[model samples]
Target: MIELGKYAGTVLAAYGVSLALLAGLVWQSIVANARARRDLERQEKNG
Candidate 1:
């Protein structure tokens, strides 16, 4: 159904890069949310 001789490597590389960037963005968003929640809790406790 598909040709893998000429474009397989390029396609795989593109997919790998896209996956890596998506993972990094998810990780960053999680870390930022955690930090914000923690800071809010700390502020509430102090004030």
Candidate 2:
């Protein structure tokens, strides 16, 4: 593993928060994309 010295806690916390935010962003993007695809399919079928 990597050592972070005296600032390890602060550094690790920052990384944890960043990782969580990124994960949430990715999840939202996937959901939104899927919804858009479904809407497009419905419109195409009705048109």
Candidate 3:
């Protein structure tokens, strides 16, 4: 890895935070999709 010298800790922390946020967004999307699909199926069955 390239040397980040004196700012390595700060840079790494920023990267970690960004990756975590991205993961959370992806997880939220998946959960939302599943819920919507289930609701749609329920509605169809009821109808």
Model 2 clash pairs are none
TM-score of 2: 0.87
Q: What C-alpha lDDT values do all the predictions have?
A: 0.96, 0.99, 1.00
List ranges where model 3 is wrong by over 4 Å. Answer: none
What TM-score, computed on C-alpha atoms, does each candidate reach? 0.88, 0.87, 0.96
Query: How close to the true structure is residue 15 of candidate 2, measured as C-alpha lDDT?
Result: 96
What's the true lDDT of residue 36 in model 1? 100
Give the clash count for model 2: 0
lDDT of predicted model 3:
1.00
Model 2: residues with Cα > 4 Å off, grouped in runs? none
- The digit string of per-residue lDDT tens for model 2 on 1-47 reads 69999999999999999999999999999999999999999999999
Candidate 3's TM-score: 0.96
Clashes of each: 0, 0, 0
lDDT of 1 by residue, 1-45 (tens): 577789999988998999999999999999999999999999999
Ranking of predictions according to TM-score: 3, 1, 2
Candidate 1: what lDDT? 0.96
lDDT of 2 at 20: 100
